[model samples]
Target: MNLLDIEHLRVDLRSRERRGAPRTVIHDVSLTIAPGEAVGVVGESGSGKSMTVKAVMRLLPRRATVGGTLEFRGTSIPAMPGRDLARFRSQLVSMIYQDPRAHINPLRTIGDFLIEGVVASGQMNRAEALEAACTLLRDVGVNDPQRRLSQYPHQLSGGLLQRMMIVMALLPSPELVLADEPTTALDVTVQSEVMAILTEQIRERSVGLLFITHDLDLAAAVTDSLAVMHAGTVVERGPSADIYAAPRHPYTAALLASRPSPTSVARPVSIPGRPVSAFEAGEGCAFASRCPYAIGQCRTERPEPRTAGTRTVACHRSDELEAVLAEGVRA
Candidate 1:
């Protein structure tokens, strides 16, 4: 069975403006992750990538109304009772936030944060959890594990803190890990190292991973498959190498063209306009205004997802766009 399965997931949050109606942030988004698979969700900021995963983790704000089926290991998430849900959150699934400092309590020692979940879940006693924490800390490359655990979050570097977060996520041996841009705040060198550790750990343990990031290159480098989201919906999805080499959607192609390449001397082309939120797009394709290949039909009609071999794309002009991308690759 797939480790995680989401279908037609829609989330609407109460607008911050008191007078406005609820605004939809996630629109009918759906994806699945198999056991031991690593799937990357990529998009520009505010494109609902984070919201999608937040929904999966059931961490959205109280004001947000969520609708859809979210299942993990053949069990429904939204319908899980309070105690079952608590166990689900603490043991079956884990989340690695983008900012470790924000998630970790500054006043608490690292040992407190690391062992809390295991102890709370009643999987291990305090002393046993501490011993396991030390082992995990060592596994993630921390030296003097006992000493480091005694130190507070403020004392550790960003990379080390992130590694610690990974250790916490793995402590319970979760079937799935939801990593929401866990390395974004770190420097490039640190980012690569952290990602390497995460990928290696997940692979060795046979855990599924849902990695959300705005950085397409990083997503491509680490994940087996990629889902490109836009305006609260997935615009394209496929194997990472296939999507990177030949993007089917105009937005996906634009994103690829915007990335700086070491070998390409030509100036990188930026997307013509800013992204539009889901509420801003009524009936038309959300990217119609910004899409270079958009036609009259694209301006008025929202396209449905269509599968072609190993990929899926929601674009009326995917056929033409595929040809264009193919030609560019040939050149």
Candidate 2:
């Protein structure tokens, strides 16, 4: 069974300006991950990547209403009782936020922050939790685990704090990890190191990972599969190498072409038009306005996800435009 299974998942928030009318933020998003597999969710900002993770964690705002199937190991997450939900959050899955500073308490020591969750959840006593944390900290390449634990969040560098957060996430031996751009706050050098540590640890522990990031290159580098999201929906999804080499969806192609490549002398192609939120999208395809291959039909009909070669794509012209997208990338 898959470690995580999400199908046709929808999330809506009550809009105050609209007099409590619900605005959809996530629409028909489906993804799955297996043990020791890393699935990358890549998209532009406000594309519902973070919101999807929040839904899995059941950390959505009180006003948010979720729909569709959200299952972990064949069990319904939304239907889990209070005690089961608590255990689910503590033992089954853990999240590593992008910004560690904001998540960590300024007043708490590193040891206190790391040990509190495990102890509170009854996973381990305080002493055992602290020892496990110190060992994990050392394993992640942080020197002097004992001294680091004595310090506060402000005393550590961004990279160190992120590594410590990785330790916290793994301390419980969770079946899955939701990493929301965990390396976004560090420098390029630090980012690479932190990512390497994270992937290594997860792989060693045979834990599933759902990595959310906007950087396509970084996502492709570390993840086994790639899911390209736009307007709160997955536009394309497949193996990382196949999707990177030949994107089946126009949005995915445009995203790849827009990235800066060291080997390419040609200028990066800039995608036209601004991205729309799920609520702002019309009945037709959300990307129709900006898609160069869009036709009259694309403007009036929403395309459902269909298998195209090795990937699933939601595009009216995917069959005819596949070559065009690949050629455009080569140019």
Top-lDDT candidate index: 2
Instruction: Write one digit per residue (lDDT tens) for candidate 1, span 1-331.
Output: 9989888888999978888899999886878899999999999999998899888888899889998889988788888889989898999899999999889999999999999999988999999999998988887888899899899999999999999999999998998999999999998899999999999999999999999999998899889999999999999989999998888998988888888788878888899888888778878899999988889999899999888999999999898777896555434
Best by TM-score: 2
Model 2, residue 324: distance off in Å is: 1.5
lDDT of 2: 0.93
Tell me the lDDT of model 2 at 133.
95
What 10-residue stretch in candidate 2 is worst by lDDT?
Answer: 13-22
Worst 10 residues of 1 by lDDT: 322-331
Model 2, 37-91: lDDT tens digits are 9999999999999999999999999889999999999999999999999999999
The alpha-carbon lDDT assigned to residue 130 of candidate 2 equals: 88
Clashes of each: 0, 0
lDDT score of residue 309 within candidate 2: 66
TM-scores of the candidates in the order shown: 0.97, 0.98
